[model samples]
Target: MASAAEQLAANMNFGSFQKASELHKRIWFTILAMVVYRLGTYIPIPGINSAAFAQAFGGQSQGILGMFNMFSGGAVERMAIFALNVMPYISASIIVQLMGTVYPPWEKLRKEGGEAGRKTLNQYTRYLTVLLALFQSGSIAMGLQASPGLVDNPGLFFVISTIVALTGGTMFLMWLGEQITSRGVGNGVSLIIFAGIVAGLPRGVWQMFEMTRTGALSAFAMFAIMGIAVAVIFAIVFVERSQRRLLVQYPKRQVGNRMFGGDTSFLPLKINTAGVIPPIFASSLLLLPATVMGFLANANLPAWAQWVPGMVGQLQHGQPAFMVAYGLLIVFFCFFYTSIVFNPDDTAENLRKYGGFLPGIRPGKRTAEYLDYVLTRLTVIGAAYITLVCLLPEALIGFYKAPFYLGGTSILIVVTVTMDTVAQIQSHLLAHQYEGLIKKSKLRGGGRGR
Candidate 1:
């Protein structure tokens, strides 16, 4: 027999959706938030010489700046106020999460302090975001000043204004994402990034067609690219939906004159517990060095430091070294993030407290060990899968010069966010149906009493 929620989902249709007023409100709010983000990408910052910056950016568009521009929804390309986007916030989050594991006080707070502790850590992440934004934006400002004609006025005031504008833009985006999370559907930050990538997708497709028409790209190659993309999408859906279920059984117990407890449940562990995070983190870290080097390229450097730019160049897009580094970082973050999000020890203790045990497994320390063992194996498979998905785009970009919008990371973000949003909508519809059923049952009971 299907579960009640599943049955409700099966019965759901357009009529059910029309009756979900709250769901409509959330969807509208999310759309409004995304629209605001898109508009911000077109609002350029002060002191940028538009023509000069465009010419300069065109030359570096195939490099790290291009990737950043894609993530920012062309905000960087436009020299917009939101050029920094929410990258600083993401970097800050990674740092804070890393700290929570190593720092004893933070570890205690994460494990024992509960909601208050989480709030404190979020505050810390915000503070760190500010610091990082200041640094990154300041570096960008100075880099622009070093490039002649890039800035309208090359002076201290221009630097201060640019820093303030970019940093303020990043902070505003962070807050906007939070609002979307609470008041709208889907993850605020991921949706923001998804909106950016999707906004550029039509242009990317048009450019590809233009290439094919101009004979720059062969028709066969174009078809192959499309086929690969479709295959990758199917692969992502399958892997993301896969999970391992562990059977958990509860002992029979007597209460008063009746038997109270004797039931079975499952502990479902996803194959990819840290979904879409490892690839995002790995990309961010790899882009950092290139960002720094790109900025410093405008500066007068000694002969010894000239090699830095050459080395950074080797790490771009499809280079072997870049691929190796990207794969390693993805694997590392896969395990690292998994450990942070799911604690086997805590899970085991909770199960033991509730008198539940896995079949043929010890209840306490041994259960924790078993869970950790299973998760580690699952993570290894997950890491390999993520690495393969992410690397395919790098290969295309490197060899075929495919558009960044078609990259695997962008596709993963788009697909994952869409799936999550749809799931939430389904859940809301199910709840609404359940409420209706309850009300109808109460009405029948009241009628009988009358």
Candidate 2:
């Protein structure tokens, strides 16, 4: 069955896609949603000077905010409503997922709860998103007021307006993501980030060229950077697709007059099971506080409060503290998120229930233990790969003035999302083709039932 499926997939062509009406609609809807998102990024927040805002963001563009600006498709640089991006939702998701590991109620909901339970959890995520948005946006407002010529008028009204606008923008993005997942292609939230990262590619290239033109980067160094980027891209694609497969053997069974014989299958575990989530979560955890501080550096803070922002500023991108925290968090989340998504205990239980067992392993607890052992090793390697990819560029950036968007996280997101989206499209096309064949078979049957 697996071989035949692979053969069928290999046979896919443009003709099949052209015949896929449902897929066409989905693709168009996704494009339209992404376009809307891009347009909104250009829409400046009210009572803000676009030029000054851009200038201020540029001044600090080498910090975490610049990394975030790349993720928001320059929205943060513009101080647009979407400057907050969909991060609040992503942060909320991380919180809820982490809670599931410790909180009994959440554990129950995630493990045994049906679709209804998932919906309930989703509702909780949205609530948390709003709360996070409120705090972050308010801090951002304060920061904006502190920057000279950035805000037209700075006061109570500006703070109130900024908070409302930023929060509303985040909520809208969360809703838009859901709509895209349901009505368009899947992985809506990831795709939003993907679009943002991709949108900055041309600009990053231009910035690289400028560095060479200004003699800060030699022509040899520029070509070397391009070469390194291509190599990194290849590495990312290869590792992301690699998986560890465990073979499961199903025992023969007798059902009535027929012998429901044994079968074998493989359970594939992806190397980077957490996808781009670890970096997003880690970046959010570190950047949220730093962002508040960055904004408040010029704010009317007392002397004690004044030094806090200054201290935190040292933890910005490429700093030792930032690097250590980022790497550790990525490793932690790699294991944590992988465990959340793939539970060995549950997998063992399901296998037992289905009369399946892994070769050379017991059917229950032992099987679970074995799976855990294998996964832990895989997770370590995956985490190391991710960390190296993300942090290796930081050192280079400090010296050569490279763009943060060129880091490993962006490459992972772009590659994984593109692969997943394409797979979904192909699945839809395959389903449509099967339906057509079935209809033709039914018509040729001359009213005789199978």
Candidate 3:
């Protein structure tokens, strides 16, 4: 039976792809857009010593900047035009979303003002991104000076040039992401990150092979790393696809002896409601404190300052403390952001207005309470799933010196985005199929009547 079901699925998938010309067009556009994005990553910004910059980055690969570089596809390492990527924009978005929850004015705007408020918020986020880019660019410039040969001019010219270029580059990438979302498949920002991970894969693989060849890494260790990566991916897929289904019942309304409206449906609550945001936010926030401490410690400082870099360095890939903290943060943000995004009260009210009620529950407050209960349980399971997926394999990878892209967050993003895009395609195909059936039915009816 299992083999037969697999065969059936394979056939259905083949048919879907075979006739999905529209889907093909959308996918090709997405690919082209990603290619353009990857190309932009390679275009270096002006006024920096490329060689020294390379060496500095090479030395700092085990630090917080490694995560940033991975996101940017080595753009940050090279100080390319897209060096900043869309991270600052993403950071601004999270900040604005959090503020909208706490501040009454922003909350009102979110609920009532709608599109206009959204536009205002988007503009504000852009301005915030610019500020963040400026700050980052300045810090990077100062860090460059610390490595004596990293800046070609090593003065005002280099600083001004880098600040302008990195800021413009980040803005350009934001625009590109918008274009992809409007004109292509999948999310633009997500696709950009996906492209970076893919581009860096070959290099990562080569480095691992080199380590093995040099006998620094063992054959068993290499096999273990590969096995762990596969397992993590499978775990991510399972958790991401998992959901809780609540049965909703609609009562029959009788008019003129005709019975109607008796139906049942399911409201699916995803296991991982917070998605990739929690881990991404955790990484960004965690990196900030470590980065600042390292910077200050670089100055005329105490012995503790020297220990700071080494401690942070250990935390970068797979140290126990880092893993524990990373997992806990993922779990915290999962619940935190889920609370902000999903409101059971509003949902239950809407269901009541629509004449729908959950099984074994009242229409309003009781239903809301039920939903809240279910969601909380699901969120706990989800947070545990996310934390495990993120931390454990990453710990193992650290044992083997594997790349960060193999971590849980990357797997989550890749799997979630792939699922979403494929679902969109399937919806389009289903709609087309229904339209074709309707047209055939109409033609047969007209012929019979004639």
Candidate 4:
């Protein structure tokens, strides 16, 4: 059945796309939203010396700061309004999710409140995002002022304005993501981050070509980088689509000479259920402190704050400490976020409710335990895959001086987002085809159609 569906999807042509008017509307809306986001990345903040700010952040581009800038769509380098990006909102959502685990009230709200409850929690996340954005933006404001020539007007007004602009930009991005999720294609937040990382692709490729032309980068090295990129993309495609299918059988039933049930299906569990979230969460969390301290390092401050920047600086890109931390965080979030999103007990209960039973397992407690066991094993492998894929690019950057945007995490995100978005588009096309078939059936019955 899945193969047949895949074949049909592959056969989708221009006519199919033209017929899918609603899908086209969603696609266009998504493109317009993304374009608006890209424009925001170029809009500089008030009272900041663009050239000086660029020099300051540009020097740290090879390290953790570079990764941050990539996610921000080069907003940090320009001191743009969107320099903070959608990170604070993501971080806040992560916090809210973590809280849902430990805090009983929050958990009840998530589990029992339904859509309204989810909306409430989302409201809480937005509020938290505002607070986080304020703190980070303020730190940036203070840092820019302290840095030589970065702030054209270094005073309370400049700091206040910087905080306001940065915070407003983040809020707007949060709203934009919500809009995309509701009325556009793909996940809004993920698409925004994807756009940011990809915006630099053209520039990075150009830089490499320029280097080869200048005899600075050997042709062999550039080709090797391309090879590595292609290999990584292929690996992502293979693993992402890989799934474990558990056979489920339904007992035969008959009523009024009509046979029902007696069919088998597979419950497909994805190898990486967490998607690209773990790396995004881990990187966003790590960057918050690094960004604050990196900026604070140069601030005209007393002796105590000096240690903060020094400690963060030690975890620069290519450092052993950095790799270890990144790997550990990825592993932790992989299991953590996966658990939050998927619950074996719930799945088992639903299966039992519907008279579905996995082969060789009881439908209730045993099924739940078995599902959990399988998920645990799969998650272990998934964590390793994610950690390896994301860290490989970082390692490459550290050793070969590759563009930061080409890192494993960046590539993983790009590939994952691309796959997900394509899947969504295909699903829309499938729905459109289904509608066409239904219309044909109605017309065959000589029914009037609108």
Candidate 5:
């Protein structure tokens, strides 16, 4: 028999969505926030010579700058105030999370400090973000000054102004993401990144078509690329939804005249527990070093520092070193993040406390070990899948000069974010249906009493 929630979900349709007034408002607010983000991407930082910078960017578009630009929705290409994007925040989050695992105090805060600890950690992340933004923006400012004709008045004033603009832009975006999470549907940070990638999809498609028209990309190759992309998307959806269900059984118990427990359930473990996080983190880590190298290559350096340009070249899209490093990072983060998200020991403890145990496993240490073993195997497969999906774009970009939209990371973000947002909408509709049922039942009961 279907439960009430399941029945409500089954009855959901377009009409139900229409009646979801709160969902509509949230969706509208999300759209408006995205519009604001897009607008900010077009507002260039002060002191940049737009024409000169655009021309210069054209040559470097195939490098790290290009990837960063894609992530920023062309903000980097335009030298906009928001050129830094929320990468600093992401990096800071990575640091904080890592610390939470290794540092005893942080680990205690994470494990037992409750909401207050989480807030404190968030404050720390914000502070770290500001510091990282300052460093990165300063590097970019120096790079801009180094390149002739890129800046209108290359001086300390310009550097200070650029850093202020870029850092402020980043902080504003972080705040905006928080607001969206509180008031809108879906994850605000992921949605911000998703919006950026989606906004550039049309341009990417047009560019691909343009390449085909110019004979740079053959018709057969274009079709093959599209087919591969479709296949990848399908594969992602399948893998993301795949789960390993561990059967758990609770022994029967009785209290007075009532009988309880003896219920069976399945503990579902997702194959890709890390989701799109591994790819995003990998990309951010790789981009940071490449960005610094690219900037330093333009700066006037000592006699021994001339190798910066060579290193930058080697780190460009399609390079063997870059591809290998990217794959490794993806794999590392997959396991690392999965461990952080799901603790087998905690799971075992909770199950034991509730008198629930895996069908064939003991309820304590053995269960924890078994769960860890299974999770490890699943993470291996998950890592391989993510590496393959993410590396395909690098290969295409390196060999065929494919558009950035063809990249697996972008597609993953788009698809995953879409799935999450849709699920949230459905949940909202389900809640609304429950409310309706309760109201109807209340009126009927009141009439009977009368």
Candidate 6:
């Protein structure tokens, strides 16, 4: 019967997108909202000389700016209003997540407060995003004035106009993300980022082919590199879905005037609990200085600025030092972000309060310690997995010169989000089937009684 249902779903067409009509409405709303986001990316900010700004960006050597441009879907290069994308929100989220681990006030709020506290935290994040957007926008505006012919005048008008425009863009993108989550199909913010990367694929491929035609790259190497990337993506999908399940048992207890019986359940721990955060943070920290260096590399004023690029270029792509630092950062952030996201102490306390235990482990501090210990080991493996998935293929596809979109972080986000979205769809489908079954059973019983 399940197989038949699966077959039916498989044969579903666009019409079946509305088989569950309410969910279909939500999906269409999300698509429409995403279209608005894509449209805004093309709307350039006012006052900047677009052609000059384009030349300035094009002339600069590749650095962190390239990655930033990738995330923004070329908006930064175009000096578009939405050039900042959703990065400010992402940064704010990271800050709030870190504070939740270290700050007592935040910790208490996380533990004791429910939906209200979450809403408060979210509000704070939004406020932080606005502040960050303003500062970053101002900096970019000043930086633009430094470029030759990029601005008509270095005055308050241009600075204020750019700042206001960029800030408004970031805020609008945030609202779109909220709409996607509430009304659309997948995660709004992640889909936004994914769309940017995907939209750049054709351009990246053309550039690589251009290199090949110019004799800078070999066709054989390009083929091999693409094959390797495909293999790596598949591997990431497999490993991310794998899990370790620990058997958990609950002891029955008498409470007040009620007799409650315990049941058994399993605690599922993923191999990679930190998800895409570790690599993202690691890249942000490691590449930020490189971005600064790239800006200063061609500047005339300072000796350090002129010499820095050559010094850092020693650790260029495929270099050992760069790989080592990237791997180590991935490992460190795996532990750090995991510690921020999951609190074993809280989990242990909740389990004890509910009369649950992990097999032979005691129900209090010991259990907490045990969980931490196990988690540490898993994290070590997880970090190593992430590093390998990101770096090894990076080494393999060194010749393809493809944008690093198929690496660990991208794969992690794609896999985790896909799993979550599929689970939601399955839940809806199951609910629909169950309701039909219940109705049929009721009708049968009624007919027999009549």
> Which candidate number maximizes TM-score?
5
* Cand. 5 Cα-lDDT: 0.90
Per-residue CA lDDT of candidate 2, range 1-450, in tens? 457567667778998889889999999999999999999898878889888776767767888778788888889888888989999898899899989779999988988898978988999999999999999999888888877788998899999999998999999999999999999996899899999999998888898898889997889877876776677788888988899999999999889988885989999988888887888888878777877877666567876676866666677677887888889999999999999888899899999998999999999999999999999999999999888887776656655767776666677678778988988998888788788778988888967764
lDDT scores of the candidates, listed in order? 0.88, 0.85, 0.77, 0.89, 0.90, 0.73
- How does model 4 score by TM-score? 0.95
RMSD of each: 1.6, 1.9, 3.9, 2.1, 1.4, 4.2
Predict model 1's lDDT versus the native.
0.88
Candidate 5 runs further than 4 Å off: none
For residues 1-450, could you state the per-residue lDDT of candidate 4 as single tens digits? 467577778779999999899999999999999999999998999997777767777678777888888999999888789999999999999999999888999999988889998999999999999999999999888888887787887999999999999999999999999999889999999999999999999888888788788887788888987888888899999999999999999988899999999889999999999999999999998898888777766567787666767776776887888899999999999999989889999999999999899989988999999999999999999999999888876886677666877678989999999999998998999988878878888897775544
Best by lDDT: 5
What's the TM-score of each model vs. the native?
0.96, 0.95, 0.89, 0.95, 0.97, 0.84
Which ten residues in a row are the worst by lDDT in model 1?
A: 292-301
The order of the candidates by lDDT, greatest first, is 5, 4, 1, 2, 3, 6
How far residue 68's Cα lies from its native spot in candidate 1, in Å, is 0.9
Superior candidate under TM-score, 3 versus 4: 4
Write the number of the candidate with greater lDDT, choosing between 1 and 2. Answer: 1
State the lDDT of candidate 6 residue by residue for 1-450, as single tens digits: 346567555554555445677676776787788678778889998888888777766654244566667667777787788888888887787788778778998877766778888888899899999998897787677667655577887789998999999999999998888888877776778777767666676776677677778987788876766676677678777777878777788888789989787878777777888877776666655554554454444444355446665745634556677678888988888998888677899889988887789988988999999989988888888888888887876655443445555444555555666676666666565555556668999999999999
TM-score of 6: 0.84
Question: Please, what are the lDDT tens digits per residue for candidate 5 over residues 49-168?
Answer: 999888888877888778888889999889998898989999999999999999999999998888999999999999999999999999889888988888999999999999999999
Worst 10 residues of 2 by lDDT: 392-401
N/CA/C clash count, model 3: 0
User: 63, model 3: CA deviation in Å?
Assistant: 2.2
Error of 5 at 57 (Å): 1.0
